[model samples]
Target: MKAIVLAACLVCMSNGAEYVVVVSKKSSFGALSVSQIRDVFLQKRRSLGEQKTIPVNVLGHDEVRAAFESRVLGMDRNRLNAYWVKQHFQGVTPPLTQPSFESVKAFVENVEGAIGYLPGSMVDAKVKAVYEF
Candidate 1:
């Protein structure tokens, strides 16, 4: 049983998708550090300099969302959920969520101050990648 579990873990790790943090191509902001991205997503920091920052998440337990949480936020689902719950009491909600990467890309592209992560292969001319993981 332990061996089977380890093998499953290895398979999941091997299949982990590459992701890139992106902003609108028209955004004046350049690349951001992981800390900056984290702060924006957590609602700890609202803007990059004078530009308002809007962070978007892939909704539900999708693999891309899991990867973003692990790589950018450095927190697993349970811990992140707990953090959101705590923040909710303070009137702080999690970032907006989209049902798909394509929608996320569109939202970031069309909405000023928007930011989101997409599978590396999905990035295109409409959005500029700020960070990758």
Candidate 2:
């Protein structure tokens, strides 16, 4: 498990990008605890305080996605897949997905209350990072 995590970190570092959870600059949603983030991502918590929150994900198995899953979600891909499968049966769908970091940033920027993760280097004035991993 440690080896896998190390590898994931190394992969991100090798690409010269650190990952962070971000929200629109206009969003009032502040920083979040890991458990809070977990709940939001899992669809256990629908909103951040009074504001409706939308969690966005990067499509496919990108390295940044893998790192976020391992470090923040604390679940392997297979386990997460199974969990989502069960969620599907219950009619709880996974978060919306964007094709790449650029699209994720765009979505979060344009959509109010939207949140997502991306490489730290990609963050700009349009988005505010709520958490770092």
Candidate 3:
């Protein structure tokens, strides 16, 4: 079992896939915690302080999205589906989805109060990375 776990970790590390949570450079938030990021993505909290927050989602099958969901949000697909269904019944909606990480990054850069996660390598000066995983 330990060997299997180690092998999986090695595979993940070998992929060189690192992820970052970013907000527009103009956003008031800085260095947010993982829990805060989770809340933003889950729509549990709408704003960071007085700034209205918009959370963006990358393509559903992207590895970055998978990493964010597992490492940051701490939930699997089944749980997320159930949670969203429950929230939907309550008139709550999930974050908006983008076709790719580049699209997500672009949206975050152009939109005030926007927050999203993507490959760390995709980050640039227009956005501030608030968290990494």
**TM-score to true structure, per model:** 0.86, 0.86, 0.86
**Model 3, span 37-128: residue lDDT tens:** 89999999999889999999986777778878889999988899899999999999999999988899899999999999878777789889
lDDT of 1 at 12: 74
Ranking by lDDT: 1, 2, 3
lDDT of 2 at 127: 96
Q: Against the true structure, whose lDDT is highest?
A: 1
**Steric overlap count per candidate:** 0, 0, 0
lDDT of 2: 0.91
Angstrom error at residue 43, model 1: 0.5
Model 1: CA > 4 A from native: 1-17
True lDDT of residue 107, candidate 3:
97
Question: Which lDDT tens digits does candidate 1 get at residues 1-133?
Answer: 9999999988876565478999999999898999999999999999999999999998889998998899889999999999999999999999999999899999999999999999877878999989988
Candidate 2 residue lDDT tens string, 15-88? 65478999999999888988888888989888988989899999999999999999999999999999999999
How does model 1 fare in lDDT? 0.92
